[model samples]
Target chain A: MDQAELAAKFRNKDIKAFERIYSDYSDSLFGVIFGIVRDREIAEEVLQDVFFKAWDKAETYSAEKGRLFTWLLNISRNSAIDKTRSKGFKNKNKNSDSSFYVDILETRDKTEIDIDVNYIRSMLGRLKERCVKLIELLYFKGFTQKEVSEELDIPLGTVKTNNRNCISELRKLIQT
Target chain B: MNVEEYIASGILELYVAGVLSEEENRDVHAMILKHPEVREEIEQIEKAIVRHTAALAPGTVPSFEFIKTHTAGKQVPVRSLQSKKTYSWITYTGWAATIVLASGMFFMYYRINNLQQDIKRAGDQNIQLEQQISDVRKDAEATEELIEILRQKDIVTITLGGQAIAPESFARVFWNKKDEIAYVDVSGLPEPPEGKVYQVWSLKLDPLTPTSMGILDQYDSDNNKIFALANPNQSQAFGITLEPEGGSATPTMDQLYALGVVSAS
Candidate 1:
């Protein structure tokens, strides 16, 4: 079933629908969580928490508000960020650098056994480093356009246009 | 309003990012419904972001069953049912019989209260027992699967004998050459020290080369202590070494805990 139909079922608290959503988006959510937390076990825990939270608050989810994937993505990112901010997590991860998502892809490329690392490398490799940073801050980190503009030292007016062009580049890579 | 120009303005990307204000979100939501191209573009943007992030996932996603159990206990708020309050002659008789059979009204009330507490205690114990039973059942299922894997005819069982550093420590490797997977049972190995983990290696003897299989990060909590690691190498031997949490590029020979050679079959 498509996401919209499944989402409606999910809102109704259907276990099968919940399972379908988990099967479909859990991996991507895991990736997003892992990118922010930078720890597999913690990421796994946060991923589960995000799903549980989503299921608990499923009533609040409206198709008109956003896509189901986007809603889940926001939950995963926020939970992961919250984890990083916790006192225990802060003490544990004091040495962890605020690495970008590309760093994760690069690390996985070397260490992971199952994934097709070359596909990831090639998909992300073609984009300029500037585009990677823009996508990272705006999309992955959930930074506002103004925040990304200041972070990257680009003009505030051009943030939207630049992000659009960068995402266009990403879309082309995905198409290929 | 220029829909094309608005689409080009990257507002859709911001909308999907969820960084947009409620007003902006409503505007985009309205635009998406009003314009097909806007909807399609939003879908494409969501898809790209999903693909981009999913690529960064380290390994296998957690099992759906695992996640299902975690969310199973979520209590859905049940709407209260309206019922007419009627005096029940049968319930009154039941209470009358108990009260008469007991000593006095106050005594009967105290006894009933005590019984209720006992029942609640028993109910709590039942729930605990149920949880234990489920945990045991899960362990049994895992063990059964591990046994099934071991019983495969083509599977090669290699006994990794304890090395000098940890002579008492031993492990078993169930290698399926056809599948290129090795299930390493490290039950015999001692718990790794803090800040250190056991890294499994696939070894080629002639050149004494060791290719890292993976680290046993879940060693302590793993009930089975059996890790399924991918070993695509033409491994003549297998070795386990204690290394820093992330594992070492090369095996720390000094901390080598277990070493075993595959018998020619």
Candidate 2:
């Protein structure tokens, strides 16, 4: 079934729908959550929280508000950010980067020689550094444009435009 | 206002990020509903971002079983309280206990008619509860270890900013040079696409040479995005680039998602 139909069933509180949604999006959602928290255990914890939150707030979601993926992404990002800001997280990774997502990706690329690191390298090759950073802040790190502007030291007006340019390059690569 | 220009404005990126103001959100929402191509573009963008970020995540993630345990635990009290209470407590306290016991025996016998149904439900719930407990234990142990890794005083943490490939994608590396280990936290990355996985490398700057450390082969299996790999080489800096299904010999500079210089402690 299409995601909209499945989401409709989920809103009706169908356990089957919930399970299907989990099956379809859990890994992808976990991917998103894991990107933020940097801790597997905490990411899993936040993943559960995101799913539960999705279940509880299913009624609030609609096609008009955004895609179901977008909704879940928001939940995952918010939950992850909350986790990182928590005292436990703060005390544990005192040196944790404001931009740790890039670190993990780069490190993994350097380590894993068996996967399609080449495809990613090529795909990433198609993109500019600004695009990587923009996509990271907006989608992965869930930073608002203002925050990204402040963090990256770009003008607020340019944040949106720069990210747009970056994502356009990304879409072109994905298409290829 | 043309579709291409509208898309290029990065409003869609902001839309996906939910960073736009409410009116802007509503406007974009309306456009997506009206234009199939626009919606399609948005999906493509979202997928690319998901892949880019997922690639940034480290190791095999924890399982769905872990997420379900605590959620189920929260529901049990409400269910149990609603179903079993009141009359039983009062009757058990008084001489009515004997009478109630006799009645309870009768009720037990009566309820035996539903025995098959009850047993099946209970058995399933029992397995689920056990799985939850196991998941919790596993999550706890992993968390404990991660905390220990970060606590090492000799570890140098370097933050790599997201390049043009994904501005929002950032990651941190805990370089325990003393132990020759680099703890990569890919928590900021999206998942790589199907049939693709992320590889790690230790780079020597003078000649711009790449050394393979290990691939983050456990991408989906790990709950946390933090991965540890051996890095015994003496390096001037670190860089990550995406390659084919297995990996590449040389760093793909464009696919280089992040880079950071090692600072002397």
Candidate 3:
């Protein structure tokens, strides 16, 4: 069902809506979280927390604000960032180096992509470096528009347009 | 606005990124609602992004079962649909049993409530009857005492005649000398006026001087108006007179209601 319909069902606490939502987005959400936190276990932990959070805060969701996927994505990013900045994380990873998405991408095993990883990898490379950075900063990193503009040193007005172009190019590249 | 410029404005990208302000988001949502093409473009953009994100995590497709397994209730929706076949029978039987039990319970409660009220009513009536029985027993005892006094050998029954002041009024005093007691049956006397009472006097008739015996107090409250007073005085005659309440020190001879002498017989 479409998001509006899905939202209505989810508001009623329909388990079916929850299941469909989990299946549709959990892996992608897991990738986004894992890309940020860089620990599989912690990523999985945040993934469950994100879903539970979505289930609990389901009533707060409104389509007028943004897409349902975007809502879930925002929650996942915030939760993962919180885990990374936690005291426990700070204590254990005091000497540990900061990891990026590119590093995780490189370490991702061949078997990780059962069949479709090659098409995706090629598309990932095909996306211009700026496009990848924009997507990473704005979507996966949950950066505000001002923060993205500052980090990319782009015009504040152009950030939205530029990100749109990057997504379009990325969409075309991954279309195969 | 042309769809190209609208699409190129990059709102859809931020829309997917979820970074747009609420007003901008709502405007875009309105646009999608107004224009099918806008909605289609938004959906296409969403699909491309969703597909790319899925590709980034290229792995075995997670089945619906894996998601369903961790869910709270694992019952298949189809199984519940199949169970609907027996729905009517199960519902009717359950409701039927409930109604029968409820009615039975209701009647039992009603009966218990009625029984309780009946018991209370019966208890009240029993108390009233018990009071009447006590009063009757008291009356019977008083009568028996009167009869026993009359049966005594030493009991002197004096017929006190009405004197010149009250010729129509008379009284009988049952004097039991051995017990030094006198039972005055004042039923023969007229009702005393308010604020006045009848006083009894014992007289030694040679000098005709009368001494106050006692006042008949609360003559109105006595059911039989029969009073018992101690007659310890050495006397020849008994007389009664009407006096004010709390009686005069000496008898009022003008209001003398009755007088009787102790004859030799």
Q: Pick the candidate with the highest lDDT.
A: 1
lDDT of 1: 0.82
Q: Per-model C-alpha lDDT, please?
A: 0.82, 0.72, 0.75
**Candidate 1 residue-wise lDDT, B1-265, digit = tens:** 3787799888888788777655567778888778989989998998898888787676788888887786676667999998988779998999889978775777878989999988866754554465456558768989999999899998999999999998998999999999999999999999999999999999999878899999999776688799999989999999999999999999999999999999987
lDDT of 2 by residue, A31-116 (tens): 67766665566777788788888877778887777777778888888888888888878434344564453455554555442223
Per-residue lDDT of candidate 2, residues B1-265 (tens digit): 5786677667788887766555566789888878888888887777776666555344454565664564456554444446665576666577677888999999998899689668856754554465456558768989999999899999988887777787788778898889889998887877877766677777777777788877777777677889998899886667666667787777677777767777755
Weakest 10 consecutive residues of candidate 1 chain A by summed lDDT: A90-99
Clashing pairs in 3: none
Model 2: residue A147 alpha-carbon error in angstroms: 2.1
Least well predicted 10-residue stretch by lDDT in candidate 1 chain B: B123-132
Interface RMSD of each: 14.1, 13.1, 22.9
Model 1 ranges with Cα > 4 A deviation: A1-3, A90-102, A105-116, B75-265
Top model by DockQ, which number? 1
Candidate with more favorable, higher TM-score: 1 or 2:
1
- Listed in order, each prediction's TM-score against the native is 0.54, 0.51, 0.50
Q: How much is B200 displaced in model 3, in angstroms?
A: 99
Model 3 misplaced stretches (Cα beyond 4 Å): A90-99, A109-120, B56-265
Residue-level lDDT of model 3, residues B94-166, one tens digit each, is: 9999999999999999999999988866754554465456557767888887787778899788899988877
